[model samples]
Target: MKHIFAALCLLAAPAAAQNAPHVVTDIAPIHALVTQLMEGVGEPSQIIPTGSSPHSYAMRPSEARALRDADLVVWVGPSLTHWLEEPLDTLSGDAARLTLMDDDRAVKLPMREATELGEEHDHGHDGHDHEGEVDPHGWLAPSNAVLWASVISKTLADVDPANAEIYEVNSKRFAEEVGALEQEITAKLAPYHDASFIVLHDAFHYFEATFGVEADAFIVAGDGSTPGPAQIKALRDHLAEDPATCAFTAPQENDSLLRTVIEGQGTRIAVLDPMGDGTTPYATLIRQFADDMVACFSQE
Candidate 1:
């Protein structure tokens, strides 16, 4: 009877591994974090393709199927990708959902006002400038990243208790990496604390606040909309009045309007990969972000 029970236990372990839950994530950065937790377990499927704007994306048929089959679906709430909330309800409705923003511990920043140009027009991105709206880019902060690792592990453990230990362990390791990266980034950005720069959008405030290397003005809005003519002119005027050393644009989002604003200003243009470059470890991606900003700030 003991031998039979031992054989059954061995069979059950492999069965659990084979039945590993299918996990799906919304964006590359979130996917990268989930990938770390599932390192020895299984990989999660990413909905947004590489280099695509997470602010707006049309889900592919395959991705839709993945959601339908998913046992767990993790995403930053609709603030960053407003288009995803409906799909989550329809396709991934039955799956275990972890909306990071909904978690109380997730640090939220107030909405940044749109550029001066946006106000001239009746329509604008985050035009109000009031404190109610939350910046969707909260995942960029080191502290927030650590919080995500903890939340993600808790969410994963709730659904897959058999592998709860592994998830918790990976979350601890991820937090450790984030701590070291934060220290490194603080030192890297310290030299630029007083240096002035501009961003094509308001995506970096969380990161900037954490490291004390904030930008002087935003060329775009808190939300991802393109600024109107008035906003562009206002930015040009702002630059004319007080020039900045660099202007940063995100991967897959820069355009002629951005180029038009920077023309003849002699300001260096650099890319900040907020989507984690789709592949590098999340920590490495943030290090790259700091490196990109520092490199641009270092220019003459």
Candidate 2:
């Protein structure tokens, strides 16, 4: 009887696994969106751990296992997490994958040259650097988040048809919440529309563009590559000529370098997390970003 029971348990394992669809997301913000959609249906697994920059992250053995076990995988694409492309192609080839950056509904921003710093800044025109280049921080745009929520819900519904209604309801609720948040943030940031700021990285272009915030320049490009000395000097010169009211740095960047650039400039230094660490709900993440910007720029 014991031998028979053990054999039966082994047979039941695969059946148990099929009870819920396993969805895997690349970063915390994407994971939050997926989790909100799958609230009453099932939970999604996140690959990138907290406090890690998606631009320079290395996947671990456990994350590899999670990728292999996932029924569906969602990510921003190679621009953000290039490290996962090869592994995901090999391991999760059969799994349904959604690259949010590739979706037509997503609003793709071009890679603006660092030298362009004002309201009438020119877009990058060099064809050599423009091909296949786009800002991968689409989640920072609330509209993109809403669009991604719809895509996620549709994908989840396809995999778990039994909970289609729940997914649909969640997606609609998420869109409504995001729309409301966008309005609230727009009003909150109205006073700072003319405020000049410098970001540690070029991740907030979408956010700034969406809300009419003036981000004068970013210290580093979108890929997290350090700027050359020449570029640093140019940034320093720009800051000196038309001083920024605030200089925002990500939690992962070096503060010393930022201080060196903004020294004696009277710019308030603030930390902005594009990844939305410690925030579970997607709405909360968006709100946190808006509030952080307001707090930093509103200071006297």
Candidate 3:
């Protein structure tokens, strides 16, 4: 009887292990990246709920529970998701975890300027203002996405070695898609290398640098910090010089101030999704961004 009971417990252990779930942070871009890498092996729940900025976000009660139960947790790093740093460290135990910035295995952008609101920022050699504190928007670059997919796949396999084969398959498929997307973006934005525009925030540093596009002015001084009179005046001067026909921003940013600032300058607002929305299969989002850029410059 004792031997039988012990055998039953052993048999149930594997089943319990196999049923474990993954929990990733709520940053949409990271969520999308993880989703691609873990498509077949398993799905990852977001720790930071949608519609909140990751820069200053705090994990909710339910998010903590999810993290506590997670088999794997993936995030950008403390520099990117500053608010979730403490909670993430506390919740993640033996769970396989990967911070894209600190992994060193992945290619990342050079550190740039810091925002008053704690967003990452970077500047390209071309003298154009880039996005985020340390260019944490590495995922914006498709090549970086390839690196991310590889890393995520490997981590997922490490967590559940039995599903290693599945992770490899997903990684390969996703990498091919990203490669194609890179080609598409290169071809699409090739014409706009000289056509400069203005933006609400410096979120497109990586995007612009990757495609050789330039931004002339930023409506918001930093990440979520709004510009003041002097800053707006500076933008007005830039507008006068560059005469940007369009202004760009993430879908989540408020356009009203941008509209007001560029109002008399004759520039129109063009919303860009930094989060890589519905077309967020990595390749698809890049393609969509290409289309948006073309539309922004081509519009009469």
Give all candidates' CA lDDT scores.
Answer: 0.82, 0.82, 0.69
Angstrom error of the Cα, residue 213, model 2: value is 0.8
Weakest 10 consecutive residues of candidate 2 by summed lDDT: 119-128
Residue 300 in candidate 2, Cα distance off native in Å: 1.4
Query: What C-alpha lDDT does candidate 1 achieve relative to the native structure?
Result: 0.82
| Candidate 3: Cα lDDT at 184 | 76
In terms of TM-score, how similar is model 3 to the real structure?
A: 0.83
The C-alpha stretches of model 1 lying farther than 4 A from their native spots are 1-17, 115-131
Check candidate 3 and list the clashing pairs: 26-48, 119-133, 120-132, 120-133, 121-132, 121-133, 131-202
The residue-by-residue lDDT of candidate 1 on 100-166, one tens digit each, is: 8877887788766653223232334434444478888888888988998898888888888988998
* Full-model lDDT, candidate 2: 0.82
Model 2, residue 294: C-alpha shift (Å): 1.1
Candidate 1 — worst ten consecutive residues by lDDT sum?
115-124
RMSD of each: 5.1, 4.5, 6.9
What lDDT tens digits, residue by residue, belong to model 2 across residues 1-300? 999999988886654234778888999889888888887666788888877888777788888888998889999999889988999999899899999999987899986566466432233222125345798888899999999999989988898888888899999999999999999999999888888888877888899999998578776677666666666776777678788888898776778878888998999999887777634687787788888888998777
